[model samples]
Structure formats: C-alpha cells, structure tokens
Target: MAKILVVEDNEDINEILKNLLLGEHQVIQAYSGTEATLLFKQEIFDLVLLDIMLPGKDGGQVLQEIRQSSQVPVLMITAIGDKQSVTQYLLNGANDYITKPFDGDEVKARIQVQLRQTMSQELAGSKRQEYGHIELDSQTFTVSGPLGQVSLRKKEYDIFQLLLDHPKQIFTKEKLYEQIWQDVYLPGDNTLNAHLSNLRKKLKEVDDCHEYIETIWGLGIRLKEWQSS
Candidate 1:
C-alpha cells in the first residue's frame, strides 16, 4: 500500500480524504501547510495531496521546497479551475490537481494513475539496460561501453544504472543520494559527489570521447547528448 500525505486545512475535507483512502492505503493527515511540511520531512510518502489555499506557507511555496529535494508526485487541491491557474500549478511542479467539489471517483482515478506511473519507473531499471555507448548488467553489476567492460562497486553501479535508466532526466544530488543510499539527504554531503566523480572517471576510462554524464551547475546531473565519435 502506498503511503500518502493529505494536506488540507478544512477539517471535513481532510477527514473525507482519509476515509476515502484508509482501506486502500496508509494516510497521514496535516491540517495546515506548516504541519504538512514537518510531516513530509519526517516521512517518505509515495504521494501527497496538497491544498493550494493553506494556512501557512501556501501550497506553491511548499511545492517549491519539495521540488528542491524530491520529485515525489504531488496532486494539488485548488478551488480555482481557470486554465491559467492549472497551467501555473503544472509549471510549478504539481503532477496533477483536483478542483474543489471534486468527484470521488475522479480523485481516486487520478491517484491511481500517479501511483502506477511511479511504480513503473521504479521497476524500469530492474534489468540489464543500455544507453548510448554504455551498457549495464544488473546481474553482474558491470558496465560495458565502447572501450571496455568494468565491474563497478555497488554504489557506483547503482548511480550509473539510475542515470542510464533516465538518460534525459536531470537528477538532483539530493534525489540521487536519497534513492541510492535509502536515507535522508543532508545538505552539503560530499558522499554523492564522491561517488559521481568516481563513476564519471570510470566511464571516461572506458570511453573518453563520449560524455555520459553532464552536471548542470546549481541544478543536477543528466546524461549528456550522445555524439558520434
């Protein structure tokens, strides 16, 4: 069952969501945005249902905070149904939004869709994979590229595998550390940087001309555009 956080200031609405989700999933309720923020830091939830009009640190602000360190699926709850508002929410990082007076079935369906997508992504890298000139073998924890094949340490292998799994997606350092280490990512931690450095060096040794990973300064890392060498 997925762990979901329900952030709604309306007592009735919060209780309604809890009742709707209780039997199918684990639900945590927060009455205000501030409470939701604290709860988020304490737990790793599979999805978040957040109300836009919150008591403190409105939903948009909270979303920015979450995006800084995570890519968790967030479904916004908003009373406004204007196209501009919905567009803004999407641009600001909400996976989806439910209008006020929402239909129960639609809410449930949207939640399911987001959860399924998350599960699919998690399972996508569970096999041998390839991208550009690099190939990763899950069974042996080895990577082969144009130049040669090399066995990687567990952490190194995981880092490379994740990059290969989503070559076009930029992974923030926080997201990488949290996923690979299965722990909270502390700011300024050098461990992920060290592993990435080692991983890059190993890849370079195998294929110097092809840049496999590119760091977007002040943002994250993603696979560089492949070039014919």
Candidate 2:
C-alpha cells in the first residue's frame, strides 16, 4: 500500500478522493497549501494529489517546493484544462495531471500508473533496508537520514543499499565496483572514490557530525553502528 497525500481545499472533493483511495492506500488530507507543506515535511508520502487553486501557495508553488528536495510523484488536479497551466505544472516537475469532475476509475488508473512506476524503480534496486537512523528505499532511491528524506541517484542509492543490506560486512572498493557497476575495479581509477565522496557528502548534509560511511584504510566501507546516546 502507498502513503498518499491529498491536498484539496474543497471539502467535498477531499472526501471523494479519500473515499476513492482509502481502500488501497493510506490517505492523508490537507485542506490548504500550507497544511500540505507542513504535512509533507513531517511525513513520507508515496504520491501527492494536489489541486491547483488553493488558499495560499497554490499547487504550483507546492510543486516547486517539493522539487527542491524530492522527486515524489505529484499528480495535479485542476478544473482548468488549459495548455498553459498544464505546461507550467509539467515544467515545474509534476508527474501527471488530473482534471477535476473526478472520475473514480481514472483516478485509480493514474494513481496505479504512478505507483507502478515507483514499484518498478524500487524493484530495480534490491529492497527496503534500514540501519541506525537511516532507511533506504531501493525502489524509490530515497534515503531517510538524520536531516530528512533525501533522494539519491541510481549509483549512490545502490551503493548505500548494499551497505545497509550488509551492515556488518565491510565491502572493499573493488567489491563495490563489481557489485554495483558490474565491472572490474581498476587501480588508479577514481570512479568509486568520486561516487563514495558524493554519497558521504549527501549523508553529511543530513547529519554532519556523525560519519555514516566509514572508510577502513585498507579494508573497505561499512556503516557506523547507530549510537542512540
């Protein structure tokens, strides 16, 4: 089941969406854009159903904010089926658009498409794994670290996922290359270091003080054990 955030001010529309999506997914409702934004930061949503016309910070603005940190699928709901609005939302990073006068079947279909795409991506990775304060969704390429949810590139995600999956085992640079790149690890090659640097930087962005990935001199890399203290 997916965790969906439905942002619509119209009480009737919100109810309809909740009713339509309740059975298959966990639905969270936000009557205004501000509420939506707050809930978004406080929760992890699989997909977002956003209405364009809202009280303060419309759907477009919310989409823009979400794009700053997330690539979660956003399906815009609009009564205005104009080319300009559609183009604007798409350019701003909305995954798809849904016109108002909601059709139950169409809503389900569109949601299915988004979720299916997400599932396929996740399947491309291994599975969901967690360690310490970090949780990695291989399917979604999202890592919930100390700071917040950060979306990762494919290679970074695969590397993190591998480490999370085998937290107790240290993976050498060559092994990581063989596992993730499916290629030989050559000496004097900086590919692994570059990716590892980027991955560490991303994690540090979430929590700078704690080292998430530890480089063991001549050994390999492993996640530091979560210290609750």
Candidate 3:
C-alpha cells in the first residue's frame, strides 16, 4: 500500500479523503501547509494530496520547496482552478490538479496513475545505466569500461547522469544549465561547455573507441546509440 500525505484545511473534506483512501493506502493527515511540510520532511511519502489554498505556506510554495529535494508525486487540490492557476501549478512541478468537491473515483484513479509512474522511475533509477560497453554506476558515481574505472566529480557526474538517465532525449544548453546548476542560462556563459569538455575527456580516458555524448550543432546534446555487431 502507498503512503500518502493528505493536506487539506477543512476538517470534513480531510476526513472524507482519509476515509476514501484508508482501505487502499496509508493516509497521513495535515491541516495546514506548515504542518504538511513538516510531516513531509519527517517522513517519506509515496504521494501527496495537496490543497492549493492553505494556511502558512500555499500549495504552490510548498510544491516549489518539495521539488528542490524530492520528486514525490503531487496531486494539487484546488477550490478555484482557473486556467492560469492550473498552468502555474504544472509549470511549478505538480503532477496533476484536482478541483475541490472531488469525485472519489477520480481521485483514486489519479493517485494510482501517479503511484505507478513514480514506481517505474524508482525501479529504473535503482539499476545502473549501460551504453555500449560502458556501465555508469550512479550509486557509486563511477563509470567503468574494459580499460578501467574512473571516478567522476560531482558536476561531471551530474551532467553525465542527466544524459544517461534520458538516453536519446536531447537537452539544450539552457535546460542543462537550469537543471544542473539551478541558475538562469546566459548566452555568454561558457560554464556548460567547459563541463561538457571535462566530462568528455573523462569518458574518453575510460574508453576511447565510443563517442557517447552527441552535439547536435545549434540544438543540444543527446546520448548516441552504440552500434551492434
């Protein structure tokens, strides 16, 4: 059963949610945003049912804070969901939005979807990434090949991990900068280029034959597929 945090200010609605999910999952309750955040920090929950309007910290603020640390699935609970509010919530990292006076079946179905997706990602993350003859042990922060194993510095590993995790997904310089460095991308910043150069050098040292990171000219970078015999 999944562990879920239900954050709603109204006692009646909170109890309704708890009762609906009680038999299927473990429900942890919080009546305010501050209380919810505190509970979230203290325990690891599989999913969060968060109300958009709350006392202390709003759901959007709570979600932003949560994104900084964990990628736990969040279903935003809203009483008044305008288009702008929904867009803003999604852009800020909420998995889905549920308007208030919810349907029990709909909430359950959405929760199940998020739970399944999160489980898939967690399972994938537990396995080491392999491309061609190279194995990247994200757990150990090491890349190994027939030549030898090389330890990656934090930034090098972060950059490599991003591409390795997504495989063929091309990431633009700006996206890489924002995701990795958590900073705005400036046109003149050579920081990403420098890191890519260092990362490539390290990879080449381990295995010279394969070119792993592909530069798509003015577009971005992606992991190249290794040819089979």
Ranked candidates, highest lDDT first: 3, 1, 2
Q: Rank the candidates by TM-score, best first.
A: 2, 1, 3
The local distance difference test score of model 2 is 0.87
* Number of the predicted model whose TM-score against the real structure is largest: 2
**lDDT value for model 1:** 0.88
Worst 10 residues of 2 by lDDT: 125-134
Question: Which RMSD does model 3 reach against the true structure?
Answer: 8.2
If both were scored by TM-score, which would come out higher, candidate 1 or candidate 2? 2
Model 3 Cα shift for residue 164 (angstroms): 15
Question: What digit string (tens of lDDT, one per residue) describes model 1 on residues 104-203?
Answer: 8899999999999988886775576777777788766888887898888778987887777787899899898888888899998899989988888888
lDDT of 2 by residue, 152-178 (tens): 877798788778778788888889888
Off by over 4 Å in 2: 126-229
TM-score of 1: 0.59
Predicted candidate 1, C-alpha RMSD: 9.2
Better of 1 and 3 by TM-score: 1
